[model samples]
Target: MHRDIVYASPTAGGEQRDLRLDLQIPRTKGPKPLVVYITGGGFMTANKAGNLDERTYVAEQGYAVASIEYRTTTTGSTYKDGVADVKSAIRYLRAHSAELGIDTAKVAVWGQSAGGYLAAMAGATSGTDRFEQGDNLDQSSDVQAVVDQFGVHDLAKVADDFDPETKATYMAPGSFINAYVFGPNSARTVVTDHAANRAANPATYLNRSSAPVALLHGDNDHIISPSQSLILLDALTRKRVEGTRYVVKGADHGDLPFLPDPEAGRKWTTQKVMGTITRFLDRELRS
Candidate 1:
C-alpha cells in the first residue's frame, strides 16, 4: 500500500494544490495492470481512500489499484479541471511505471457516479489534447478500458430522465450540476446551459478510436437514471466502439446490493459484482 503519493501539483485560482493517489499493488512476480479508481461525491468532494476495500480486492486479483483524488466543487474546480487531474494522474503513473510496478501498456479507469463521468471522459477523449494539462506530457493518457457505474453521461438530458421530484431538485439553484460545472451562484442550470452541458458530455467526444467501455447502472437509481447508461451505450454503438452494459436490479444510487456488507467485514464490492468487473477488465487489459 502506497499512501499519499503526490502525482501532480496543478495551480488553481492562483494557488497550487497537490493531487495524490493511494495505490495498492498485488504481490505478483512482474508488473501488473493498473486500474485507477475515482471516488464519487456528487462532483463536490472526493476522497482517495473512499473505497479501499474494493481496491484491495482488485489488487489481490493480480492488478494494481490506484484510488485518485481530483479537484471538485469544494476546491472551486469544474468538470474540465477534474478531467485534467484524472489524465495527469494517468500520465504520472505511466511515467513512474518502473518504480511503481505498473504495466504501462495495460491500464484502465474505473469510477462510480461523478468519478464514472470522469472515467468516461478520459476514455472517450483518448489521444486528444483538450484536457492533457499538467506534467508528464510525453506519456499518453489513453486508457485501454473504462468502467463507469451510474455515471451521468449527458448532462443536457440527464434531468429529463429523472423523476419529477428528482428533476426539480436537480434543476434548482445551487444544485450539483450548477455548483460543479457553472459557479455556485450562476443562474445557469443544466437546462439552460446546453452548450456547457454538451461540452462536458462524454458522448460528445466518442470516436471509433475511443477505448472500450463497460457501463453499470442500477435499475432503481433515482439520482442518476438508468437511461444515462443507455444513452452512453447508444453513443458507443453509434461509433462502433466496443461497449458493454449491465443493469443491477433493485439497486439505488450508492446503496446496498452493489456495495459489500460492512457487518460481514467484506470488501467494497460483492463477490458477484466484482467478478463481473474483473472479467471485463481482464478481457480488455489482460487479453
Candidate 2:
C-alpha cells in the first residue's frame, strides 16, 4: 500500500492544493492493471482512504486500486475542476506507471455517487482537451473502461426521474446540487443554466471514441434515480459506444443490500456485487 502520494498540485480558487491518492498494489509479480476508485461525499468532501476495504478486495483480484482525492465544493472547486483533477490524477499515474508497477495500457475508473459522476465524465470525455489539464500533459488520461455506481449523468434532466418529494428537496434553491453546480452558496439551481448543465452532463460528451462503460445503480436509490444510468446508456448506444447497465434490486443509495454488511449477514462482497465489477474490469482491462 502506497499512501499519500501527491498526484498533482493544481490551483483552485487562487490557491494550489496538493491532491493525493492511496494505491493498493497486488502481490503479483507483473505490472498490474489499475482501477482508480473515487469516493462519494455529495461533491462536498472526498477521502482517498474511504473505501479501503473494497479497494483492497480489488487489489486481491490482481489489480492495482488507487483511491484518489479530487477537489470538491468545500475546496472551492466545482465539477469542472473536479473533472480536471481526476484527469490529472490519471495522467500522473500513467506518467509514473513504470515506478508504480502499473500497466499503462489497461486502466479503469470506478466511483460511487458524486465520484461516479466524475468517473463517467472521465470515460465519456476521453481525449477531450479541456479536461486534460495540470501536470503530465504528455500522458493521456484516457481510461479503457468506466464503472459508474449510481451517478448523475445528465445534470439538466436529473430531476425528471426523481420522485416528487426527492425532487422538491434536491432541486430546492440551497440544495447541495446547487452548490455543486454553481458556487458554494450561490442562489442558482442546477438546471437553470442550460449551457452549464450541458457542460456538466457526462452524456453530452459521449462519442464513439469514449471508453466502454458499466453502470450499476440501485433501483431503490432515492438520492440518485436509477434512470440516470439509463440516460447514459441511451447516449452511449446512440454514439455506438459499448455500454452495460446493472440495476440492483432493493438496494438504496449506499445501504446494506448494495454494499456489504457482515453484521447483517449480507455477503454482497467479492462473490456477488463486487464480482460483477471485477468481471467487467477483467473483460475490459485484462482481455
Candidate 3:
C-alpha cells in the first residue's frame, strides 16, 4: 500500500485542504488497469482508508486500486467538489501513469453510496463540464467504465420523497437521506430550479459517448432507493449507453460482510457482488 500520495489541494470553506489517496498495486508488471474506489460517507464524514479491504481485493485481481479522499458537505463542499476531486485523482494517476505502471486509457471509477454517485457522474459526464476542478486539466478524466454500488443518481427526486418527512413516521433524515448532496436544503428547492437539478443530475448528461455502466443495488437498500439505479438505467437506455444493473435481493447499505446463511453457512458473502463488478470492468476495459 503506497500511502498518503497528495492528489490535489482544494479550498474547503475558507481553508485549503491537501487531498490524498493510497494505492495498492499488484506485483505483475506493465501498465495495469486502474480502479479508483471512492468511500461512502453520505457526503459528511469518511476517509479513503475505510475502503482498504475492497481496494486490496481489487488489487489482487490484477488491477491497481486506490482509496481516494473527497470533501464532504460538512466541509462546505458540494457534489461538484467531490466529483472534481475524483476527476483530479484520475488525472493525477494518468499524469503519472508511467511512474505508477498503470494504463491511463483503461481507468475505471468504482464507489459505494455517495462515492457511487460520483463514480457514475465521472463516467457519464466525461467531455462535458459537470465538473472540471483541481489540477491536471491536460489529461482526460474520462473513465472506461463505471461500477456504481447502490448510488443515488437523482438528488431532486430523492429530496421530494423526504423533505418534510412525508414518507415515513420515524426520523427520516437519519435513515432516509435528505438531499444534502449539493447543498443544504437544495433538495427541498430542487423542484423549482430545473436547470440546477438538471446540471446536478447524472442522467441529464448521458450521451452515446458515455462509458458502459454497471449499477449494483440491493433491492432492500432503503437509504438510497433501488429505483434510483433504475432511473439512471432508463436514461442510459434512451441515450444508448451500454449498461447493466444487478438488483441484489437481500442486502442493505454498508453491509460489507458476506453473512453466511444457516444451512449452507455461505449465503451472505459479497463475493458474488464483487464478481459482478469485476466481470463488467473486464469486459468494459477489455483487460
Candidate 2 local lDDT, 184-261, one digit each (tens): 767777667778778788888887668999998877776677789999999999999999998877766763323354
The count of backbone overlaps in candidate 3 is 3
Candidate 2 regions with alpha-carbon error over 4 angstroms: 255-270
lDDT of each candidate versus the true structure: 0.85, 0.83, 0.76
Best by TM-score: 1
For 1-287, candidate 3 gives per-residue lDDT tens digits of 78999999999888999999998888886778899898777777648887565667778888889889998877667777888899999999999999888877888999888888889899998877658877899888888899998787876565333436644422233222333444654434444556766777888888766788999877665566678889899989999998888887876555232112232112223698677877887887765
Off by over 4 Å in 3: 159-188, 255-269
For model 1, the local distance difference test gives: 0.85
Candidate 2 least-lDDT 10 residues: 261-270
Off by over 4 Å in 1: 255-268
- Writing each residue's lDDT as its tens digit, candidate 1 over 1-287 gives 99999999987656899999999988778999999999887887788878676777788889999999999887678899999999999999999999998897978999988899999999999968879898999999999899998888887666676678888788776788777778657788767878888888999898866899999887877667789999999999998988999987776676222344443223226787789899999999999
* Leading candidate by lDDT: 1
lDDT score for residue 249 of model 1 = 76
TM-score per prediction, in order, is 0.93, 0.93, 0.87
The clash count of every prediction, one per candidate, is 0, 0, 3
